[model samples]
Target: MSKQRVLTHIDAAGRPVMVDVSGKAVTARQALAECRVRFPADVAAQLRKSGLRSAKGGIVDAAVIAGTMAVKRTHDLIPFCHPLPIDGIRIAIDWHGERELRIDCMVKTTHRTGVEMEALTGATVAALTVYDMCKALSHAIVIGPAKLVGKRGGKRDVGRVV
Candidate 1:
């Protein structure tokens, strides 16, 4: 025997519907999401020598700014997400290795719904911004595995920042 899991965004008739959060208690919630941007070997070397700046300007700085903005506007972009007043957000873009950049977005809020989507949106948008700014450097640049790393203060709490 197995328990059947119901989709929150779908009604019994199967039409798409937003989840109702009005009855849910408002609480402090946080989510952490991550993404990675990997540059080709040659491009990575060039970036290092030039201090991670493209002709467009500082790559890391731009990603951070874009990610933060995305966190706030997540509701506008995603259909099911509720517009939330963000309590705090931190976007960190750093070198994971010689050729890879890691982007982490942590979002916090006091709301009825969790902020996992917001964090994920922030990290992924930041990665896209990185790719956009560096496209001239190389079309082979890769962005991938945008994922929710952790979340807390909801029906189910999971993971933690170490």
Candidate 2:
């Protein structure tokens, strides 16, 4: 058989289409995504000095909650996405050196499709939340690109990093 094209989500005319996963098996799927945010030296120093409190109920705590909520509602936010019952979602935010912050989101589900989107959405939103909170300190905040670090389940597991 000729190599099958990766156009399941597109029609012969190349228009966007949602793939039908009704026949796929329900198996545990997991995905990890990450994003980074850079802060000005002064802003980073201020944040580190203030500890976790910043009139927003602990910056890291709020980010984790926001990221988890985003993961669960990824389908609602993105059109044409199938809503899946998420088994678990975790968001971890950490200081990368003194001028950058890293956000990582891990999503787990037993569903027909993988949860890579959920992980990506979670990480991106968390990074945005950080930017929003720190913008008061400096408009120089920069949110970097978000990428899927790893995924498992579905037709084949993907371990490539971008």
* Backbone atom clashes (below 3 Å) for every candidate: 0, 0
Per-residue CA lDDT of model 2 for 10-50, tens digit only, reads 78899988888999999999999999999889888889899
Stretches > 4 Å off in candidate 2 = 1-5, 160-162
Against the reference, the lDDT scores of all candidates come to 0.92, 0.87
For model 2, state the Cα shift of residue 9 in Å.
2.3
Error of 2 at 91 (Å): 0.8
Candidate 2 shows a clash count of 0
Which candidate should be chosen as best, given lDDT against the real structure?
Answer: 1
Tell me the TM-score of each prediction against the true structure: 0.96, 0.91
- The TM-score that candidate 1 achieves is 0.96
